[model samples]
Target: MTHAQTQESNHLQRGLKVEQKKILDTLLQSVYRQEGWVFFVYGSGGIGKTYLWRALISKLRSENHIVLAVASSGIASLLLPGGRTTHSRFKIPFALNEYSCCNIDQGSDLAHLIEKASLIIWDEAPTAHRHAFEAVDRTFRDIMQLRHPTSMEKVFGGKVVVLGGDFGQILPVVKKVGRADVIDASISKSLTIWPHCTVFKLETNMRLLQRDGKLPAIAKEGEDEPMWINIPDDLLIKAREDSIDEMVESVYLDLLQEYTNPTYLQQRAILTSKYDMVDKINDHILKMIPGGEKVYKRADRVCPITKTGVNVEALCPTEFLNTLQLPGIPNRELKLKVGCP
Candidate 1:
């Protein structure tokens, strides 16, 4: 039996939740019937969205069908088998607009892959700019037209495309833009495909369910600061002189003992919104871990705009470059620990 069949067999042996089975059956039907249906799986984190995608992929690939799994983020793409970033797979341009299409020719190898794919699973759909999806749509229509003349009228070129993401979670990141612009860039807001796509919601939080916990209720409109949900008191670290120490202890308890353990390191993390706070937390954590830190410094020189005979280092000194905290750029000096990721 094929690898997909083996996986599907294992899945069957384990059994699926009722909702997952229903959705899997529906998706399989779409692929089998060649309905060219567009589906959106809406679910929050730890809601078995990835699980469903795996089941669907297994079932389709078991039948010797080509399944393409792509995600908006690199980390998310790693969750699925044979997965790649949407930008990498589609050759989407970094700077996107409504008129943008993938950098793919109709007779290209990538285009042929799209044409042969029985189902396309795009995870973390909301995290991407809508233009990216529209670009793929335009490209798919153009490419699949070779197979069928009517492919132009269909979504994703008569292919069953399943998009999964949580709208409640991260939306498309629009740097130096207002909240409105970020929202406007989301697939639901910017793409006309949302109207045509069938949306299925996974209500059950599998993680919470495993812990015998309940899913939090959705906030109603006009509620007092609906966006601001009060975190549990125990979860919050009270501000104090030793608050950083307290946070480090709480998050990375027994850090010294299990510092080298990848699982332990992977499971716990201290998240901060600001870079200053991040630096503070990281410094505190580093100090806690008993190890000699290796410092690596990068030599910085300003990119010469003109081929003028001028000393670049004299223009921007090493000390000044090291102090510069530009957005998306790493620090000039990096302090590493034995256990650091």
Candidate 2:
């Protein structure tokens, strides 16, 4: 391997903790040696789920096992040639539909790909649809003919699938899949008694700063932290407005002292929107600045407004112009210049 690859492999191997080591050992023994293992490692966000999978893959590679790591986010980056979304991987549409065995052929390539892999690590799996999982399994079984008793019964059929993700972050957007969904699906397959299928929970917050007493306890199972402060809306709004004004004044003074030319002052004022409302306060600055020269030129401004409704269409100003809503906002579109003085 190249120097970069060697360094990355070494780094991944070195990052494995005690529990991660135990999990990796169990997975290697059960999934590698046995057939049809679907191992899941679930945890809360920022809890090192991806790190553990990377470490496992590195370890497996060191032992001469072929590994493929895939995720919903980095489909293009993770997939060889080009990564694909989870939906594309399973040959499912963005919208969920009824489960059908007919769609199995659509996922033939993925099935063949997985059949050749020794270990298939699917990260961010919680966002995958339940039907998508079933479709993938059925497709693989059909394509590889692994479901048949005549086909290499002792070879473990295909790749051992390892799924890792945080169920709490976000469930499947197309179709909801939770602990109950996993249980129901497993029971349906008559593989519930099989030891190869197991759920492993990883509990520990290694990402957050522990010095903050408000931080949630790093445990496998516990109650969430309670809210300590609650303020009324009126006071909150006033405080925010005061803070914005203070920030805007600071930016104005800084620009006056620092910039000698009008162009530089315009640029500085434009950058000051981080403190106050960009459109409202910036427009005032553009008009007030010397030379009657707007920070944004007339040609630089573009209108973005859309009309709605077929029969009773009405004009609605864009966000840049409309700051507050009175009541009963109508569906309409009104064109207005951006950076207008």
Could you give candidate 2's per-residue lDDT for residues 164-205 as a string of tens digits? 777656565533676665544431233322244578877765
- The C-alpha TM-scores of every prediction are 0.72, 0.55
What Cα-based lDDT does every candidate model obtain? 0.85, 0.55
Error of 2 at 139 (Å): 1.1
TM-score, candidate number 2: 0.55
Instruction: Say which candidate scores most in lDDT.
Output: 1
Error of 2 at 94 (Å): 4.0
TM-score of 1: 0.72
Off by over 4 Å in 1: 1-9, 12-15, 173-184, 189-192, 210-258, 273-341
Clashing pairs in 1: none
